[model samples]
Target: MHEKHKSHQVSGAHKWLKRSVAHKMFDRVPVVPDNFTIGETNDFLKTHIHEFETINYIYITDDTKKLKGILSVKDLFRKNPDVPVLLQAHQDLVVIYPETEQREAASLALRHNIKAVPVVDHEGKFLGAVTGDQILEILNREFREDVLRKAGIRRSHMMMDNILEIPLWTGIVHRLPWLLVGLGGGIVAAGLIARFEEILATNLILAAFIPLIVYIADAVGTQLEAFVIRDFSISRKLNFGKYFLKQFILVGTIGLILGGLIATVTNVLYPDSRIAFIIGIAVLGAVLSSLLTGLLIPFLFRNLRLDPANASGPIATILQDILSILIYFAIASRLLS
Candidate 1:
């Protein structure tokens, strides 16, 4: 009866832990009581050190188990053994609450450059610490999630321990959604170009520049999307206004240089100042619009609780292609008329 009761309690704890947050991952390492002097700490370590797997920093706590400060093993060894442990302890505590998400707890450790983060209750009582091993696990899980999400795969697929063991149909189902969306987007882009038939037919030269405009716009948007997705994965708090301003400055500069080069080349090859002017202005407009579209699309998806990387790639590319065609034709029609 006693063994059964103990097993039941363990099972109950496990169930409870599953519903909890960062507290569930807490590690119960031995903590040094704040009142212990350096000499006493040394004696305690000599006797009780076997209880711990590894000791990087000694967590100093008060009698009631309230965290006081921390002392590194390096600092402890360098100090006089007769001195109080608190004297050598660093008071700047970096702690996380039990309710914090595991990812957030790991991110905190990373941001602060610490091996582990201490878990505390609302009242500041120390519960346990999140070890470096746990942090590593969380990082690996997050990395896998980002990769799979970017590939347009469902997060539930992470449960499949072996990738090669997954059924062929399951893989196709996961990949087919994005491909279908891209197909629809391609149809829409084709229709958009068809609407500009008169402009393309009137000036065959404009048709030649269409590929150049679309390619440059897609390239610039892809670059911005990759940067934004990576940054958002690590830290969600991005200053959109400032980021947009910076991107605008960057895109504007590049557009001018690229537009000038294209205009110069077009004038030399075609010798039509009107055509050269229209191409240059259209290129500048298409690039600026594409850059803004790339930045905003990811942010919109992120706001909608969608994975920015998954949606940004295909959608941004399609949108850039369509917008570049529209901008290029609109400018040519206006200038050449």
Candidate 2:
């Protein structure tokens, strides 16, 4: 049943939360109480320590199996084996409910450097532990999907066997929406490009490098948005100034070098010095505009209570395309006319 849902291809962060098998697994995770105690923390260590290779700490709970506290193995070593129970050595336990957001739960575990933390129900009963390893696995899977998505690859066909082997009709259903969005955005960009036809006609040479200029800006913006969103997902504060300048300088430098190369190539090919110069300037402007767009749109979306990554995808690309077309034309008009 869950496999069917997992077969659906979802774009952005929605894929992990809405279409992932892990999300389904998490939904059914168990819950336990707080008072659940360890009869012998030592005995649990000796018995189950070999069972789970990554077991870092042992939890002690009550008669009802409600988690009272947790004790690290280091605490066990310091105390005498004859001690009735090691419950006193427990520090303040970190517990999360079953419905806790997966990202939040993972972030807390990473922030605290905990090996695993006990999960609990509303009544504070012991559930299971969310291991750091589990979080690591989730991160790895998500990262792969993110990288693939940036390359414009379809994700549904990649992860789940059920998705990859589905009938052509069912498979097309999953792919159609993303293509529709991309197509709609492309048509809008085409209209913007058409609006700039006068400028292109005045300097026909500029048309040669439109793809290069637009792509450079769009790529830079996408990269910046993804970097910021990923860092934001971690503990780092969103440093606007630092992020802006960092992307500005990096994209600016690369764009300058690339523009110089494009200008040189065009000068050799087209035999028009002024057209080449205009193309170079337009390229540089478009690159900067793109970098700024990449940085601002995500932050803007975040302020508007939206997922920044959503702004990082096809919609942002289309907007960037329109902006790049405008910038390129405006630069060409000024420089050539």
Candidate 3:
């Protein structure tokens, strides 16, 4: 990341490696010559430890700074320190380009258990290292951003999807089905809520949780929608049956944990086991059902030759809300009536 390393930039001055986040994230590493003996490397390290930003691995390079190998601190002070450092350092290494995406770099670091990913130029010259601490921060930040983006808020670029390029009538046709379906679904939802009017009056507390149940279901559906859309962009032939079966298991487990925790907490706070049981059971049902709507709507749109993201994103969110309400009230009425 320093000015001196700028000379090693690949393909003139405008290469991806020089411009990507990998360039900014890398830190100055402790480097040694490939021909140096272990004893000499140790002496150099003792004197220059403070000069390095990350010392997780000692990089071995040639006079031209072409990375040759690497060794841990333990390997540097092994029983025989007189041999050339390359004799002990690992040569077959996992590395990334300065142009590599931050998430990808973090993945490589985790997959190899290397703690850090070494950044190298096209010519195999070392640039620097993306350290362990940096990797963790990158992953954690991505996770939070992903959760917020998929559930809490959504950001979309219709231009990227070329929605404007399509003919107006055709676009309308693509979107119209969901709008009409949502209109009908909305009417059904309102009628259903009205049908539950007596249940609500009998236990007014039941009304307070309508938004929470709807949000929990919609949030889960939105996350799956975002993830599946992204996955399709990356690999179009991704197996949905595999994804479908896997979600049942994963979402089922999540439902059990969340349901039981809420049940336990509600019973303790409200001292009403029946309300707790009803709320917990309703939550589990909503979550499991949301998973189905999340996956199904996207595929349904794709089958109809429309953009799946368009359907699952904004147009069909009402589907999950409707489903959640149906599940919640159906369970509540059965138990209470």
Evaluate model 2: give its lDDT. 0.65
TM-score of each: 0.79, 0.64, 0.53
Model 1 TM-score (2 dp): 0.79
Give candidate 1's whole-model lDDT: 0.74
- Summarize candidate 3's per-residue lDDT along 100-130 as a digit string, tens digits: 7676677677767887778888999887788
lDDT of each: 0.74, 0.65, 0.73
Question: 123, model 2: CA deviation in Å?
Answer: 14
Kindly give the stretch of ten consecutive residues in candidate 1 with the minimal lDDT sum: 1-10
lDDT of 2 at 173: 65
Ranking by lDDT: 1, 3, 2
Per-residue alpha-carbon lDDT of model 1 for 268-296, expressed as tens digits? 99999989998899889988986656778
* Model 2 agreement with the true structure over 136-188: per-residue lDDT tens digits: 76667667666645544466644543766688887676556666777887887
Give the number of colliding residue pairs in candidate 3: 1
- Give the range of the ten consecutive residues with the poorest summed lDDT in model 2: 1-10
Candidate 3's C-alpha runs over 4 A off are 1-19, 46-51, 62-68, 110-113, 121-125, 136-140, 143-192, 195-241, 252-285, 292-319, 326-337
